[model samples]
Target: MPRFAANLSMMYTEHDFLDRFAAAAKDGFQAVEYLFPYDHPAAEIRKRLDDNGLTQALFNAPPGDWGAGERGIAALPGRETEFRTEFAKALEYAAVLGNDRVHVMAGIVPADADHARCRSIYLENLAYASASAASHGITVLIEPINTRDMPGYFLNRQDEGQTICRQVGAANLKVQFDCYHCQIVEGDIAKKLERDFAGIGHIQIAGVPERHEPDIGELNYPYLFDVIDRLGYTGWIGCEYRPRGGTSEGLGWIKPWLKR
Candidate 1:
């Protein structure tokens, strides 16, 4: 059976960030993931997870001046020092949060920026991240965000992410396969999963067009769940989506899976 983790970042907006841990556990989620834990102390976040019996499945490294519209700095030149500093902080939190996966976002670049230069910087940053994280038994992840939602984002395809992982050549480095992004950029979801399963570190899902509950989207999640099972993917499937109504009210779609 495919295990699902509630994405506290997007789901359970009805409660405070810390309080969302219990909300997700109450909803039968055994694990939880969020965008960034820097706002709260790692000890506080760990306490919430321990209190709710929930595992911290995944989270992103600091994405450099989010308020300034910078999504990430891993791909940006002259930001290597900043990226390493922020990524080390992420690993420190992961040590306390007990999560094995840390996603390093590829920052947006200028339309006229040199693509080759960006790729070189990205690969170097990823190599550093993977090597540093491996010492602590942690895996670093790279995700391909859809251009429609995140224009100018450096990475935009599964193959591109996988190829980067190969170039980085670290056992602990892998791709974060997000179904929502894949459906938008490439329609052959199942085949892609099968083809790229070897390099996938984690998986995420949401409605294709609206980024809502998985069941609310065009993709048949139930069928895809079966496909994931057949593919032998033993990783958490992050419920990274917004609720159309109350978060819990829209959780009926996951009840059956939770029971299993």
Candidate 2:
């Protein structure tokens, strides 16, 4: 059976961000991941994790000005300096927090921008991050977010992500396979997982169309879990979903999964 990690950013919205660590542990999660952690001090977060006996599985690097609609700066034309600075900051946090994986968002592609130029910048930036993160024993991750939720997003396909990983030629870089976005962009969930299992570092799941709990999704998570085990994936499967009701109340699916 796969070890599961709660996505505190979306899973435990009922409590304050700092308190979610305890909430997740009380609810039976052994690990946790979130979108960003720049707001609070890393030491504080680390203490919470230690207090709860929870491991920090993953978290995203700083995406520029999230409130202003800038998802990430990595693929942006002239923001290479900012992108590297943000990644270094995240690496600092990860070192103190003992987090090993960090996702680097590829930013949105401008409608009128040159595609080749953007791809070039993205690859170089990833290579830089991969080298820097490797020195600290941290791995860099790239995810293919669906365009529906994030229109114009630079990376939007699994194959493209895999290709980028290969082209970057960094052993520390891998794909963050999000099932919700994968189903939206390409429907073959099991086959895709099987094909890319070697390059995949992390996995996230949610209901199709609604982005809710896995138990209420169009995807058959139970069968997919079987596939994950049969394929020999040993990483954490992140529960990156909004609960249909109270976060704890909708976790009936987890108990049965743990028993396996």
Candidates' RMSD to native: 0.6, 0.7
Off by over 4 Å in 1: none
lDDT of each: 0.95, 0.94
User: Compared with the true structure, what per-residue lDDT tens digits does model 1 show for residues 102-122?
Assistant: 999999999999999999999
Quote each prediction's TM-score: 0.99, 0.99
CA error at residue 180 for candidate 1, angstroms: 0.3
lDDT of 2: 0.94
User: Alpha-carbon error at 215 in model 2, in Å?
Assistant: 0.7
lDDT of 1: 0.95
Give candidate 1's error at residue 66 in angstroms.
Answer: 0.6
What digit string (tens of lDDT, one per residue) describes model 2 on residues 71-182?
9988998999999899999999999889899999999888999989999999999999999999999889999999999999999999999999999999999999999999
RMSD of candidate 2 to true structure, Å: 0.7
